[model samples]
Target: MTVINVNESNFKQQVLDADVPVLVDFWAEWCGPCRAMAPVLEDYANDHAGKVVIAKLNVDENPNLAGQYRITSIPALKLFSKGEVAAEVIGARPKAQLEKDLAGHVA
Candidate 1:
């Protein structure tokens, strides 16, 4: 529920300028894997709370942002810290696996 829906207009302020780490989910509406990853990200956002921020960007709606990040795939997770990408994750994954993948940055 805490996941903020980001678009080209606010991407800079929301993700790039965030005080805490921001996990931006680059996904599309028709992508099956992206849909599957939604709840996992939501759970992560809720659990992490103030430690990190979760943002969802629809590639279909904001192709500019997707292209800017070189998102060739759906469900691409880019962790932004201090205005730069700190980590990246691709494809759909279980919550535990996603957590493990981001452990270093999230912790």
Candidate 2:
């Protein structure tokens, strides 16, 4: 699977209503770390495939979601399960570390 781009319009159906856990990466184009985390998320999306859904929501473009989720920084990763946020990672980190952080919810 590939990393999907989510926005205010599709966030409900894609992340909130997903049968599997969804990891939504809140990022912005001006953020260097966000840029660096892109490929890592893509790899994760491919590796996890059906186990989880990886999605990206641009903070710049979707300010409402950023505010709703309280995203104060770039590269904020939130794992959603059953329509609510289950876990969160606040920085750009390695895939192993990220997976470990969200291990409980991912599995």
Candidate 3:
């Protein structure tokens, strides 16, 4: 499964009100780190599709949602559970680290 593309219009319903846990990646086209995290995120999307919902939000195209989320950094990863934010990662960390961080929700 591929990660869902999140935008200002879908932010509320997609992440905030998700029935399952959500991993939202805030990224931008010009951001190197953001680009770097894409493949890892894609792997997670495929590996944990049914278990959790993964989304990618482009900060450049959707600044409204990014600003609302206070995403000052590109490639920021936020975990949402039960309609609220549960955890956050603020850099281009390794996939192993990401998995370790979201272990509780996915596993």
Could you say which candidate leads in lDDT?
1
For residues 68-103, write the lDDT of model 1, one tens digit per residue.
999998789999999999999999999999999999
Weakest ten-residue segment in model 1 by summed lDDT: 1-10
Give candidate 1 misplaced runs (Cα > 4 Å).
Answer: none
lDDT of each: 0.92, 0.90, 0.85
A best-first ranking of the candidates according to their TM-score comes to 1, 2, 3
Which candidate do you rate higher for lDDT, 1 or 2?
Answer: 1
Minimal lDDT window, size 10, model 3: 98-107
TM-score between candidate 1 and the true structure: 0.96
Q: Which has the better TM-score: candidate 1, or candidate 2?
A: 1
lDDT of 2 by residue, 1-107 (tens): 75789999999999999999999999998999999898888888888888999899999999999999999988999999999999999989988888788777765
TM-score of model 2 (CA atoms): 0.95
Candidate 3 per-residue C-alpha lDDT over 1-107 given as tens digits, one digit per residue, 9 for 90 to 100: 85798888888898889888889998888889888998998888888878788898888898787887898877899988987888899999888988898887775
TM-scores of all candidate predictions against the true structure: 0.96, 0.95, 0.91
Better of 2 and 3 by TM-score: 2
Q: Which stretches of candidate 3 lie over 4 Å from their true place?
A: none
